[model samples]
Target: MPNNGCVAVNDSTFELHLKKPFQPLLGLLSMPYAYVVPHEAIEYFGNDFRKNPVGTGPFILKYWREGEGLVMRRNSNYFEFDHKGVRLPYLEAISISFIIDKQSEFLAFLLGNIDFISGVHSSSKDELITRAGALNPKYRESIKMITGPYLNTEYLGFLIDTSLQHVSNSPIGNPYVRKAIAYGFDRDRMMLYLRSNLGYPAHSGLIPKGMPGFTDSLKGYSYNPDLAKFMLAQAGYPNGKGLDPISLSTTEDYVDICEFLQHQLSEIGIPISIEVIPGAAYREMMSSSKLLFFRGSWVADYADAENYLALLYSGNFSPSGPNYTHFSNDKFDRLYRKSLLQSDDSLRYSYYLKMDSLALDYSPIIPMYYDKVVRFVGSDVEGMNPNPMNLLMLKRVKKIKNDTYSR
Candidate 1:
């Protein structure tokens, strides 16, 4: 294991010997990867907690059965309290079912068998939400809809590594060509029709909506068929005459979206082919640098700009790192490294903006949309707080009896 730039000074205190003055301490706190475990329990837990788990959280694992469900009981000794000094974890027990099909999960939610239904499925969206992207009037009284920005950015990555360039489609390595493709698609229409407005059209940089450094002013490529044609000519592929068919690699879940993109790009003379692979195989191909054009999403690991920017960092190339597109620019690399060391809060944000601008200029990836988290809960369920990270804090969640509605 690598050193964490931190050292124990005493039993109760520790010091972080950082490589830079600016430390992402707040971001670190929210990451499970940065968690510290009880060292003394290694022997007792056999270096694993598959069966016997331990935590100081608000719930305790009580029962788990394979292919069925799991149950957790509230921790009576939980240390949190409400403003009125009431104990946290108002609910006595929580149950989780291992349902594979999303339709089944939706049915369970409709039947009042679950406390909440989040990440609304496409199949159920029309039934639960109106075409105008509001909760259906019929279910509005019984279901409480909570919607907010989630820290996730979906994009299409372009392989900038010239080594992966095919003799037939050399234009894929050109920034202008990439920008042309970016400008050819209609993100607003996709969000409205395909996603049912579940997300915001990505008009910003790679940084998603609701993140600390995200800004609306960081301009992104929008739909413009004429500009796309001009860009293709500028990239030395007049009317996409010399360009070969661009193949896009993605999973089954996103095939429809890719197909839509293919149709839109074809109007600008860019022939596109859609390849739908299994999720696991698609990931493997991406990690192995086998796919040149692909779909990817970045969900914040720590709600920081660095988490998303790291994907474009040259040092983080795939197989060993997250830079699947193999995008590398010396200026981007220098600016990113400098951003990590700035101590001043305002200056650090400026550095973040500069790096984001560099990404926008290069067009290594086409920003699609920033995902929104949606949750529907029964009226009886209360005290739930919706956050950008979509973290579930069951400590304050509770279910109450209502004679008017059956549950």
Candidate 2:
């Protein structure tokens, strides 16, 4: 391992080092030896094999049995201490068991097996809420249900490919075709059906509402089948007779949304073919640009308009690039560059608004709805804070003696 962290290593060098058996093993153990491990067990494991760990965290890894559970013990040698001079992580041990089945996980929670459960799935939200409410009023106060707005936003994206290109050298590049598609669907009605008024209808912009630089005045498309048919016919796909069947791909979670879109588009004379694939396969197909239209969601890596705008319209493509729609506009790109260079937040926000306006006008991808992060925590756990980014901060959390206790 290189002692100096400033220098960059090429891909070939990384691959070569990774392939060396003992080198990779040593690399995994090196962090602990440096006292950088977050838990004690990690270091202990490294030391048992003649390697050493330098981790100084509150917990130490004790045992890990594959397909069973992981056990971590509180580390007395942990560097941090409370104001009263007591060691952190008051609990003696922490155990994590992988329960792939969510229903089983809920049952375990009911049986008092786990201290906390993060990410309550959308399908189980109603049932979980109802059950939690039905408990004794005193018990309900102890059992915390953390809910917050999340940065994640879901959308339907159109794939630009050679098959859809026309001889005008522009092909399916016509903005009218994109606009017609956007207008064909009834987003609000769909949200009511699928999410039960929990979601907001999408406008034709890349920056979702509630984020900085988002504008309600720049609404791009609304539910108007008549207008959609007119635009499609104007784009020369009258009654959808000559146009090829449009394919909409999605994962199982969004199949219902796709089906609703399929029905709505049918009303506008646009035949849509639904392709429901596994999540991993769907992502692979999307990256390969094999699917014409697909469903995707973006969870913000940071709280910035640039994070959302740059990903979808920056004229760049991925692994780090998020221009999944392959949308390119010189005006938007120029504004984005200018915004990044500006040091002042207000100036940057002004440029962001301009960029957002341009993106809405172009109508590349159809925005869906922003998501919410929901979770259920046990009655004994306290000081658990949930952030809008969907991160659970449990460093200050401690188990209480009983349901009535609070810290």
Candidate 3:
């Protein structure tokens, strides 16, 4: 195999040749994007490939009805076995509903029409989850809240490439201004009120709380309006007197969070304006470097910390890669290169810490919080545990037969 291609040694094996050594190769290959789709399946299904997927996973596509619903049954030919020697995929079938409204989805879950609902949505969050981030005791007997660290870090990225005239003209291009914004707002307060205390304040490096390289070892910004004022003044804008209104572009879903930041930053002498954009359009603008300051979040495709760090790598500058900030640092690049060559976990983590430290010091991005996977499951569901990555692996999940069960 050459250039990004792989070779199949046999029906059971395939291998890829990398130009350089990489520590996270295994994790990278484990991603589902490279899963093999059989030629027979494609030829047979033709335009119906999306509805009739053929893969080696533990589940098989049973049927789909456009936007109405979908069903997947356990693959009888699957080879995997459990610790107890039982064939994998204990659940007979998965029934997925297409409920567009968040509140309606919540109601479906409450009425036993659905097994679980993912994340804390604004519509039904306050009714089910208390202000303290606990499931209200009123429905505790029939509902269970499964919470865990999610491998996602929500943040705001700044276009730090001063070579661009727009960036040079804006106060946001200044490192001090970026650091000021990072320190201006109270992350804990934002989490408590807006997020219902569902996430941890990003008080550490960008690797997030659950990933391996994530450590309290590297310091990050926290609430400090006084320091924010000092940093703003250091950026040559005294009390935001001559500073321009920095617009934070975000999607409609996260407008509330951006508004919260806008309010808090305004009090700290930093005028912040919120730009609400449609989800698809916002993504296009962000990836193409069309926006200077934007709300973004990174979810791990693999378990490696490189996925997050790659966002700041110089070679990954926007339009072609993920580096929206266009931040290039010689020291960070060297460390990142060295990390790829390191096979030892501890040594690689040390490099990660140093790289993260460098990125945080520059303050190209203001990490808002490390998101948490919050699942509201019906009491009748078992083995509903979610991992840090939040990949839905339903092989071990089972639905306890209940009289009230609807699906």
Residue-level lDDT of model 3, residues 3-105, one tens digit each, is 6667777877877787779888877766777576776889999998887787888998878897899998889888898999999889888989998998899
User: Where does model 1 exceed 4 Å of error?
Assistant: 1-22, 47-50, 163-169
Q: Which lDDT tens digits does candidate 1 get at residues 305-368?
A: 8889999999999989999888899999988888788767677778788888888888888889
**C-alpha lDDT of residue 76 in model 2:** 77
For candidate 3, list the clashing residue pairs, or say none.
Answer: none
State the lDDT of candidate 2 residue by residue for 295-342, as single tens digits.
888876556767778665546664346676677777788787777667
TM-score computed on alpha carbons, candidate 2: 0.71
Clash counts for all predictions:
0, 8, 0
**What is residue 110's positional error in candidate 1, in angstroms?**
2.2
Instruction: Candidate 2: give the clashing pairs.
Output: 32-53, 32-54, 33-54, 35-54, 40-60, 41-60, 41-61, 166-171
User: Which residue window of length 10 is worst by lDDT in model 1?
Assistant: 162-171
Please tell me which model should have the higher TM-score, number 1 or number 2: 1
Better of 2 and 3 by TM-score: 3
Task: In model 3, state the lDDT of residue 108.
Answer: 83
Residue 170 in candidate 3, Cα distance off native in Å: 2.4
Q: Which candidate would rank higher by lDDT, 1 or 2?
A: 1
Whole-model lDDT values for every prediction: 0.85, 0.67, 0.88
* TM agreement with the true structure for every prediction: 0.90, 0.71, 0.90
